[model samples]
Target: MIKGFILIFLLGASATYCIAQHNKAKSAAIIVTGKVLSQADSNLVKELFFDGLHEKIVNNFQRASTNFNKVLEIDPANDAAMYELANIYHTQNQEADAERLIRMAVTVQPENNWYWLLLADIYKQTQNMAQLVPVFDELIRLSPANEDNYFDKANALLMQNKVNEATAVYNSIEKLYGSSEDLSNARQRILIQQGKPGKAAAELEKLVISNPSDLGNYLSLSEIYAKSGKRDQAIAVLQKAALADPANALVRLSLADHYRALNKPDDAFIELKVAFADPNLNIDDKVRIILSFFPQFADYKARAYADELASITAKTHPDDPKAFSVYGDVLYQEQKYSEAKEEYKKALVLNDQVYQIWEQVLRIDITESKFKDAITDGEAALAIFPNQAPLYLFSSIAYAQSGNHEKAIAYLKNAADLETENKDVISQIFSGMGDSYNALKRYSESDQAYEKALAADPDNSYTLNNYAYYLSLRGENLEKAAKMSKRSIELDPGNSSSEDTYAWILFRLKKYADALIWIEKAMISGKVVNAVQLEHYGDILFFLGNKEQALLQWTKARQAGSASEKLNQKINEKKYIE
Candidate 1:
């Protein structure tokens, strides 16, 4: 009996093994051809699918597509193979083929999340908003708890101008995840886009009540109110936000804006001061606020506020070069040039790569008459930006101011060479060259450069005055010099320098009577008479045969510093010694 039981057990075990093998073969067949496949064919299809994936990864798209096609030929229902082929087509911008293949893949394996996502992306890429809606709907159905899928559906609906439907989707998200500021804001935007700002404001109000501690909600509501012209309502919302989050700098800024709009200048300034005092406010925003005060700079109160705000920016953002740079701009505009130069230098020490800052620093140095510093800084700037004509021009000015006429001419030539189609810059360069050459006693070159400068800018008063003065000093071209000097005076009436040049040119022509009148005008036109003007007046008076009065003027010229050596000789000799 034991032998018989053993044989029966063996037979039942063999039958169970056969049935399991048969079911496995049937599953493989469904995967391949929806019919039974031989074990060899199933293995080959699997091999091809993996090889296609490897080829795709290696960017061998043609080979990848070939292998995928072979796998699909062997197993027509292979959704993964279809998806891979669709990806290759998508990459090639064959969207129609991609769409057809991906749709087939989704249809074959409707529950494949990746397949649905690819289809949705394809719809989005094609801008087929209408088609994208159902794909996102399917995605939502597939992944019911996925919040991103709901957002995608809402966006698709919004693209179709289906505001109500989009709002419903956003509402669905809130239901799934509880109330959120993002959802509320999204709904608000949709309502606002639909021209129902009242509804939008209502939506944001709901968020504010739900999350009273969140200042962002209040700010959003205030913006909407402001945009809708409810100025008082906007101010009230911002005030509530500030009370809720007293430390928020952005809220304070918004409050300042609203207060200003309400025409309450004191309230506006108070809020602005609070906002600017906050260390948490970003440097860029502070810079913007400071810039807004530019138009109001003529008002003492506005100027003081701007100055205080700039100081705060410097303190809060000590390492930020922009902070100091912007402050320097404010001071420079106010004509506090020396202080502006210090600020720009501080900014450069922090960060020297900004070209605009370099420009500002050099400009301020020139304005403050820091000639040595300007030359040092301008040369460094030129090294970094050799092609910049403005840098060359600035460097030339620095060299000229420092009495390096040869170097000045070289730098000015470089500026003229680099400047194209900018007649103003070219004119300035030639004018500078004229000055440098004249200083070096290269009178012919100086005269040529001056002519070119006048050709470029006929109304250049500075050039006219300097050119006429140089010609008069040389005792050549007196008539032309007199005409240019007169034109310079006409262009810049009451300019002491032009008046002095005309008077000197008149003296050179031996018109002593005419020279006396202009020399006197030059001395009185300026707030202070310089040693040069006093000496010139002495010479004109002596030429007109007033020895005693001329001697008196010479003594005064000596009292003023910078009187020429000849003035001392003439004073000692008790006569004109020209």
Candidate 2:
């Protein structure tokens, strides 16, 4: 046996990242071979090899490499030791060394299944696909019954786009072990990629005969027929699947897909209803199928179908909270807030631990101006999830809306430390604190909180608009407020709230003509122009010496639910009032 130190350099390129702003390329290396020498003792070589394996298992790759090299020194033709060291080299990303050693090991131990497999793996990892097929072929010759070897060889060939060779490998698999779904599907894929859909259909047809009991095989065959524009043939094959098992729900789903492709949406809906009603199909699979088609359900008609399908899913799986939650999601998206709330309530009754479902219910309550209900529900949810920062933030908003700023402030402070790394959530909590402080007439605290919120997320348009508007209301920092409100409008282009805020800031700065332009833009935005916007428009007009129109707008503001104390005064006195 040869006993000389083999200098195994770990051949990985390392480049220093620039602190000096220049590329400094250098190759970093480590010596992997060992110094320990021994006579050709077979027993000692075996012990050292096992010791090397144990070291590798413990993640001590350097020591493992040392032991393996020592074993190889004791027995120069130790293919097992050579393979282990090659694996270490591969792990270290020393690809050249790994490939060389693995190749040598395979040559030394041609009959060893593992040596050939390692060589195959090395070839694959190096992207040297041209050499991989022969190694897998040798593995097959060595262990002909190993089915994985056949698949690996086919996959390797497919990687090279060797369509003929890959199909041949699949054919060989079928000839040796009979036609199977895996082999036939693999071959059909190659045929399809080769743009021979006709030949792909032939392959699946053969697989359908061999695997006659697998409904999946018939489905695949039907799809291939459809892909090849043989719609009639596809329907006939799906009919066979139905006759094969009259209760198979998947066949109904397949027919629905075919009918949709044929533009017979009504027929598709009928088949979809049949499929959704079948208990044989797993509900989880049904959920996945429906979600996959969500993009197609963007139109009102298809969305209604989606709602119907979601309803069927819920009734089919009445015990599953997820089913009701999905149904609520559909209704919520359609703006059927009341129906969505009922479905969400049903879901909570079944399982109230789901935070997102509670969040959805709370959002609807807030949207519908049910602040007391929102506050109550939020408190119950907080008792269950005490550490959730978003719940506290949302609950504080409800409290603030209910004119309970002290409760809102307490909740917002409690939320400050529970936040995760999401800066938007953190920013929103601070912004909520700002609003609560402003509502309580604590201007200094409100300013500090708004500053902190901007620090967390400088681009938050809500914080910009609110802080600017509050500063304008206090009649302080009019210049700063003008800048911030303008920025808010730039951030959310065409937003009525931001535009109204900008107009109000301009009015506070005594720029009446500029304020009038922005106020008119906000009024015509096609969105709901809230009472505050109308009141601001009246103030802007009054400042611009249009008292008649200004008083008219103030009345409109009061009529539109302005709850502002100065609004009635402005209309009755026929002048602008803050």
Candidate 3:
């Protein structure tokens, strides 16, 4: 979700304005055609003007512009006023006005290090490195002792692809400060960039040896080693760094990432937990590390981490209710149902404002088939976050399972109202409702639910097969049943239930020859081995003058658990003697 240029945008905006202002001030001096600052009493004027300028910073560009104009009117050589005005205009994105002021500022204060560095940052933002190179040169001349100045100058040179110049400045800094840690670090980066990773590694090693306790230096060494295919060395360096600064979560996180990359997921998770325990660790990192546990371990680990996290938070914020909800999630994931219920109860006790958590508890109860408990939870969830879909869906299923068809149908209707666009879900709920009604022998209500499902998806294969089979069983709408059965078979030619429905429909219509053909076809479809289809086929055969084989088929069907007991009796009793 986060990207590379975000850092640039965060820190670059102010620096960009500074550089743009400097460029403008220089051009303004050329245009004004006069000395921007007078030699007579310049220091006294600068001191007096600097305080007023500092105070004027709070003024907006409109007020600041008027004030700057007054300063310039009093003394036409007031370069400081011009520079301040330039900064204000640049901040306002009035680039042309800012440019006019900055050109004058730089012309008046050409030798100023601040003016030159500010110009360099603008050039960097605009990617105008050619103009930036000379500004840094002037900057270095103005402030040679400022180590950061040299470092910045080298970086500007590096950006311009002037590698040799960049390396020379870095070396000069090193010679001046005799293996200075910062310069040493900078030189190592240059070495890596120039394809001398071995040299970079050696340079970092020397720096770490001299500054044994510098965590940044050790991290640098680890990075170099890892990049250079020396992972063992990288791990050793991180371990040493972590040992030196045991409280640094960054080092611990790096160590975990390193272990994860090495195929030691368990070890990685341990380091992650350690990092998570550190109060100084970023909350985002802690959450990420906790989430990275393997899915198989999520149940146990999320629960344990949630418990630890709760304890840690509650130690300070003892009255917080959200922590209990977090704990409940972990327990629920682990299927510790009673413990989870207790936690949810604790959460509600602390605050009854958690609607979603109530829904979660209800879901858990529904999953465990605690129908009465589920209704209580669902009612609570609905009271808070009214019209929540999961609550209705789960409550409907639970009510249906508990043999409360009226409550189940009511809940299903509510679910349908809430999720109108989920036609498939609505269809499934209606189909299930129909099945429940049929079980209660409420034929008209069952038929209406089935019709509702068919209206949602006219050719839904499962619904077609089910409704058609129901009709054939009731000995009604035989023609319509045959059409729906054929449609089901067309939808999924190899589906066993569809095949069984088609064969059974043919047998119900007493089309014995056609029934035999389809029963054989259903067998060849290879999706089902239904005993009912086998027995029906035997009946067709017996009706078609194949008595011996018909008896054999019936015997097989009976062994296969067909409703063939009556057929077996009739065959044994010679009831079909013709």
lDDT of every predicted structure (CA atoms): 0.84, 0.82, 0.71
Measured against the true structure, the TM-scores of the candidates, in listed sequence, are: 0.76, 0.71, 0.58
lDDT of 2: 0.82
In model 2, which regions exceed 4 Å deviation? Answer: 1-46, 57-60, 87-98, 127-129, 144-196, 199-212, 246-249, 278-285, 292-298, 318-321, 341-358, 376-388, 414-427, 451-578
Instruction: List the candidate 1 regions with Cα displacement exceeding 4 Å.
Output: 1-128, 171-179, 190-203, 379-389, 413-421, 509-521, 538-555, 568-578
- Among the numbered candidates, top TM-score falls to 1
Q: For residues 1-578, what per-residue lDDT tens digits would candidate 1 score against the true structure?
A: 11111100011111123234333222211122233456888999999999999999999999999999998887776779989999999989899989777766765666778987988888888999877876776677678988889988898889889988998888889888987777777888898898889999998888888789888888899999999999899989988888887768888889888888878778887887788777778778889989998998888877777877788788878888988998898888788888887888889899888899889888887877888988999988888888899898888898999899999999999888899778888889999999999999898999999999999998889999999999998889999999999999999999998999999999999999999999999988988998889888989999999988898999998998855678889898978875
- The residue pairs found clashing in candidate 2 are none
Name the lDDT value of residue 238 in candidate 3: 90
Highest lDDT against the true fold, candidate? 1
CA RMSD for every model?
A: 10.8, 9.5, 10.8
* Model 1 TM-score, 2 decimals: 0.76
* Candidate 1 Cα deviation (angstroms), residue 204: 3.7
Worst 10 residues of 1 by lDDT: 5-14
